[model samples]
Target chain A: MMDLVYTPDQEAFRAEVRAWLAAHVPKVPLASFDTAEGFAAHREWERTLASGNWGMVTWPESYGGRGCDLIQWLIFEEEYYRAGAPARVNQNGVFLLGPTLMEYGSEAQKARFLPAMASGEEIWAQGWSEPNAGSDMAAIRCQAIRDGDDYVINGQKIWSTRAVYADWVFGLFRTDPASERHHGLSKILVPLSAQGVTVRPIPQLNGLPGFAEIFFDDVRVSVDNRLGDEGAGWQIAMATAGFERGLMLRSPARFQQASRRLVSLYRQHHGDLMDPAVEDDVLRCYMDAEAYALSTYQTASRLLQGGSIGPEASCNKIFWSELDLRIHDTAMRILGARAEVEPSGSSDQEDLGTWLDGFLFAQSGPIYAGTNEIQRNIIAERVLGMPRR
Target chain B: MNFTYSAEQIEFRDVLHALLQAEVGAERIRARWDTASGRDAALEAQLRDFGLYSLMFPESLDGLGLSVIDCALLAEVCGRAALPEPAVETMMVASPLLVDVLDRGLGNGSVQAVIEGVMSGDARVAVSHAINPHVNFVEDAHWVIAGVADAIYLLPRDKVEVTPLKSVDPSRRIAKIDFDPEEQYRLAEGEAAAAVLRSTLNRGALSVAAQLVGLSEVLVEQSVRYASDREQFGRAIGVNQAIKHHLADVAVQIEYARPVIARAAYTLSVSPERADIAVSHAKLAAARVGLLAARHGIQVHGAMGYTWECNVHIWSKRIWALVREWGDEGFHKNRLQQWLLQSNALLGPEFTFGRRSLLPDSRVSDPVSADTAA
Candidate 1:
């Protein structure tokens, strides 16, 4: 019937979530999650969310989730961002790895890791993308040799987001020494405090170690930590990447919230900005945000009806990343000199500092999550069915 | 609630897609553009026989009684072929408007007969909207539903003046309209007239947006197909990152725009009061994406695209004309800004899907809620 409205129970759930967030969300914004103190503070917030079973709404209740549908998850997000909740410090664990675990992990694996991940007790970082394998993830060189029911890993992973402060990392490691490319890859989880592991922070332009570099030297992990079939790491990692790019990692609510703030910013400066071009750009932010949200709803509904997200995730990735750029860029135009100021942390609408920080971070959107160039290639060959020259 | 189209809607869109591809050739669409007669009588009769004109006729009028949701997707298929018959305007806007006027007891015996004729494929209606400042397809219309000075009326084509104007899109036979005002045919006045006008405008805007989206789809799809077949530098042109990336960007715009258009159509049908911004957003997204596809579609096609030899312009040209019709970009932008800039306006993620989701204090007992509770 193409009904786009929420149901009564869905609305009821939203009410519960809104009231909870309103009551508990920090009155003052927490520091950026990139810093050690901020990382700890945000984790505390995650604990608060977990206390109310709002950690991961769609995950089963046994795993500390409320056992809600995707619709409720979207509503929770809408309210989360609307209420100005702190940024999630465990995005890699909850958004990407958690969903993958649900799909491919053993029951025992779920019981051991899901609760901690939900409660923010153990934050996880991704260990994909070695020094040599940025967009070409299949070219990973890290190896984890299986020995007596234990895998000893030795290699380096760069661009390991949150590795500087995280408790663990789950990444792709080559298991078969003789095999090449994607064939020998195995998905394994390793503790950061394990022996022979060194973490080096890579300061971004913001002078924060938002991501890190990990050097693995004889780090030992039980073979029981492996997910799915041994040779199927490429497949499993790809499924996770699909989740990252398509649905979970970058929900449209985030951008919708940003655009709403952008509209307020634009309206605040409407008298000085009569330039039709600037006006059009502001309108585009709103339109793009709405368009993204609607597309997600369409996707969510289709998924609920048993359709899996596929290469269309490539389109979604490109849309949101570019949209993020447009939104922050437009905010910069509206902010003028205010855009360059450090965080005043006054309010979200007037938060020129966050916009400035976002402007810098949004540049990584096209580069990370499989560079926009590679995404366009995927869309061409896979989604649009064009030939590879 | 679900957002995907129902099975019946999909079937209708697919059937129209096949029929338009087979029957409405490029030459037929170009018929009105050339010195040949502006109307395709035979094709018009065939579309009427297909019951295209009666799609929105109320069931009491012995019709399928469909809304914009069932037909707008098919409009996208029609846009792919650049259908020149004004079927979207007649079926979506005019038919619904007629049903509204009649249901309000404003229509006389002749208007009833016209609606009956529409249901029987014996009549086609053209709308002379006040927002448009002109009439379209008057050469082929059996009647005109004209809005003027906060009043509505029914007028015959002969009684109204339709001065044909050359349009950027050759297929759109636009004209300045002048009709005699008669009290006998007045449908409604004041707020009732405004209500009817508002409904027609949203539906018409949605129709145009659907067509624009349709054109955008064909442009991207055809460009991809062309780039795949055409070779350059010893390989398929689509092999180059430049070409693939351009087409991919257009595809992204189209992907996101479809849902916006769908939501607009749904809002218009289920919640008309809330449809203004939805339709505006839909048109804005559609026009922007449509233009992107047009520019990039031609760029990928090379010199052949620039020439008359390529049919890309057929889709591209209509995008230019239709984008300006039924409220252009500036009009929609202004509308959105008006609502957003209001001092009390609530702009955030909570307001995106309307305030229904955020208003938890207000409760309603419905079957779906009961099921979820159980």
Candidate 2:
């Protein structure tokens, strides 16, 4: 009744995943998928992976996946990170929207989007937060007016990751002219190639166009693009958000890989560094990552028993985001002055410069996928059943 | 792989929780605080009759043949209720050692009497591990189980000279025991003794971890209840973002720790060889959350938590005591580091559940995946 042993099939699957990744994972790490060249390179890698049917292992085989369970997906991720495989440029499509579509989209929509999503033929940018709708997502005011067979969308989406090189965007828009807040909104899938769509790249702290501002000027997308029914966008978006904030987007193995690297970073410096605090920090990172991994497995186990991820997703979001911050923060502290040194050409620079890049990027962990403050409030009100203001 | 409790495990836990709820409330726990022994005879007897002490013994001895996994949640229940008993050692720690010794044909005459007495609700046994010098509830114990250097003994309580100590937790009757790990009382020696001692220490840590997790829940629950009822800034403090956030953080820690503790119990039951590492993880996580629960629990209570009259202090103080006992922070942290520092330490998400297989090594060839020798 209580067991933690992975089945022989699962072990074989992990071995197969490891072996394939070892053989096919790029010898030279692909560039950050934010730039155009990097984007195309990552897309090529995804195509290579898709050729091996390694695109989104949890999805059905018809959609270019192995139709694996969550455990297998976790194993796939473990090997993926271990292999230092290129980041999936189509994360927004495969990780976030793909699951949402499977849950809420029509059969036609699934057939239309999933294979391309998994194959990285169409990279997606999430249109979640706006200038006014950052933490308060219910403050969404973007309009998508219904006209005959098309919904002409207008207004802007800010902080859209990958929108700079993305081919499509999935967003929430106000359908009813009189509608306010989260009500009367619909989730619409739109192509960046649409006539009136404008993608303006936003340079991040590291001076990269990792983000973008998407402006839709009366862009007409077919009614068939709307996921679920009109006015049901909030519920559908929340489910997508549950996937975003929970296991799918930021898997535990990602942090574990980071933590392992952090530990390696410490071991290299453990001799010269007299700071026991660094050792403590490294230990905390390792243990916290393990705890997070164990927690995900527990959630997956429960989910396998037909349980849904509830408000506990907020807790997971907060845990991993903050953990990501701690890991990079510790690496920076361990590196000290040399942390900022971009020793790019040298092999020594790989670990050093990678830590610096990760440190810069880790700042966004607490901000994106819903802020930690907002997550804490959700945990309080929903999970703890506390009184809300 | 299933990570769930059986119907038997759940039912036994529920019944024990029900009985503890009915018999050993905060008031009952408070009642024992005034006495140095911290024993409620009526409640202890009821607990024994309800299959608490005899839970881990063999079925042939008129006891439930339950392992640590089945009995683990009961430790948590006892913790949640702040049950002032040495039930942890009697059940999770000493019981297994007693069974092991019995299997070696060592429980003869007096040892056999002690075993039968403990099972049949007539006697209580407290244990003293080498890692923890202070024995809790020694005055109330009929026999003392002591593990030292290379031998373990089941000595009569009267044989050990006990020195009373100033207790931190009001419900704990703390003492340092001077037990002779002599021949007549010795249960097992040499490798047999070391093996039992190692596992028993892990069991102690795991049981305490379960209790700490449960203790943390009480602190959060009490604070949440108080925050909702208490008004501040013209509304219930529970509505304040500050209060909610504090409790929420504690709740998050609890959510993570609960599964780790359960996993530790599973490890102890299924793979005792790996229990040290697993149990240390459980211990470290529980201790962290337990301490966090106290810090936030007190802050959320304001002046009330600082007061002795408040029940929050009762649970908080118990958390403080439990955290320092059963392989403290440094002990467990060092244990984990030692295991993790090994070159062959199979880490990553895949090895989290499964043991090291005979599968030929791959992936460790990756620089980051390669383990550094410590």
Candidate 3:
């Protein structure tokens, strides 16, 4: 167990990433973009990361990737956020799409797509959740009928994050509509640049087009674009979701940092008018964050030691997501009416506004990446040996 | 980072538990407490004959030479039995340092006598509060290993006047001691004396904390069992959220206290540099949580648990006594804050461990020093 202890080399690796991020992350007076400009700047930031060979960490070096260990990738992320690096524009690619491509994409497909994907030349967006298939992906009605050597896809995917600015779309399509619910699906990689594909942005309560709806009309893609075997789309999509559960999504240290920030903010705003109960709540948040960090570290150690991410990963996800919501909520409570006040000027205004943005975004944490309800159900049914209804 | 016990440690704990259960079972524990020495003489003799009493001493001193972790494991079983014995006073205090002090102060004659006495179970020594400056229980002891602000006071049982005091736990004796100031033995003095006493006292406190953790485990486990087995309104009381959640809270306390106690014991055994903070944390955490388990054990067991006929009161009183023994929660927390301020401010980031949210609903318990010390 103590073998999880880091050696000097790991510390040196952390230092190296810290120094690199501090030097390369732009200090430009860039606005917190909520529109197309934000997307452009975010894309530019991804390019900057690519230039530093820090993009697609843990991906093969042959595909413009570093081929670093997961620990190294985590270290890079830690420093990236510590240095206040710009938002990762290709979150869909790096988190959801890239790993799937590496796992199920053919050699020709990898050779064709991995480099551009890593270099931030082409951004990918998820086209999985549709109007009727939000939580029920197998209920998807999107059809991809095979014609000659090409598959003609015609369907509408909704709540597709970043599809409005995406260069390509990757998702599951029911290639055999008459087949069984899950057996009918096939994972397809479709180019959003196709003349028949149309994208429309959906404005969220946060006033950002963080999501979009994409309509496919006779879009054509070669059979080679299908990941894995036919009717294996459910397996491929599950693998992507599994990756999202593990290394691709939030890091526990990230939550730890946020919890610390909440503590510091609480300290900053201490006054007689403030409710003293907030103090205990803030401390509770810190404890939750710490426990979650320890749990995640244990998970990372297990993975490093060649262990599979088991049902415990679900526990870690449920823990950290709930912790994230609590910490952000605490920050909102601490900010009080200022959270409601729009920023007129100054960085303090921007910082408070950004926290408010995070507060708004954090509401979806339990709903996304396998809802906490689903997670608890898994824990009760699979891990805790409860009888399933 | 390794939080597991070695196989030897596990075997040792198992054997010790069996020995304790057979010798000083709960049935005999109360009667032993009513005795003069507050322990079972036959059990003590057997443990001594088995080399258990010599754990903290070196081989050169005719001891088993075990680590503090070994002592902690043994103490835990003693805690579970609520067995009032001088094993802690001797192993934690007298054997480790007093023997050497005796050797130095009164030459080899006194040293040899005390060592043989401890080994043979004939000579029972206790720490007196004369040294503590606030409390004294030396009169209740055959030999009072006492210390003062500037001197070591070896107040023999014959010298100090003793008066029995009302105690929260009748199983252990507590007394007010009046000592002759000029009769100080002065075994070790000044900074060296202070350092030795602090180290010894801290080790004792750590041992007590570990034992309290063990006792809390018993209380919580038994309460949980009772809750599961006892039915109320056609279902086990455990089904009631109030009862299960209380038991769960006690479970949380045990979980949180275990690591702090382990860390404190480990620090005392391996690296003394970190002992102060580790012991304070351990004492504070254990005492606070132990008190909760004690109180909740009663509530969980209801009216039957509050009576002397039930063993719940036995565990509760023992927990209460031990909580206020060395340094209660308030004193230890103050000490921790003091140490935090006075110590070299290194990279000590204040990250709360275990479950901090549970603190709001739990009451912190005080530490109980045996009659010997304040």
Q: lDDT tens digits, residues B291-333, model 2?
A: 9999999999999889888888888898999997888999888
The residue-by-residue lDDT of candidate 2 on A1-389, one tens digit each, is 77777778877888898889988998988778887888899999999999999998988999889889888887888878878888888888888899999999999999999999988899899998888999999899889999999999999999999999988999899999798898999999999999999999999977889999999899999999999999989999887777544888888889888988877766667677555787777778887888888888877877887877755677888888889999999988988888888637578678788888888989999889888898898888887888885
Q: Write the per-residue lDDT of candidate 1 for residues B170-198, one digit (tens) a residue.
A: 78778888877888777788988887888
Candidate 3 lDDT over B161-215, as tens digits, reads 7777757776767776667765345467776666666767687787788778878
Best model number under TM-score: 2
Q: What is the DockQ of candidate 2?
A: 0.63
Top candidate on DockQ is 1
Give the DockQ of candidate 1. 0.67
> How good is chain A of candidate 2, measured by TM-score?
0.98
Worst 10 residues of 2 chain A by lDDT: A266-275
Q: Residue A61 error for model 1, in Å?
A: 1.3
Provide fnat values for all models in the order shown: 0.86, 0.61, 0.07
Models sorted by TM-score, best on top: 2, 1, 3
Name the lDDT value of residue A253 in candidate 2.
85
Stretches > 4 Å off in candidate 3: A1-6, A28-34, A65-67, A96-113, A127-158, A169-188, A194-197, A216-219, A231-244, A270-273, A306-312, B1-272, B275-374
How much lDDT does each candidate structure score? 0.84, 0.83, 0.68
Q: Is the docking of candidate 1 incorrect, acceptable, medium or high quality?
A: medium
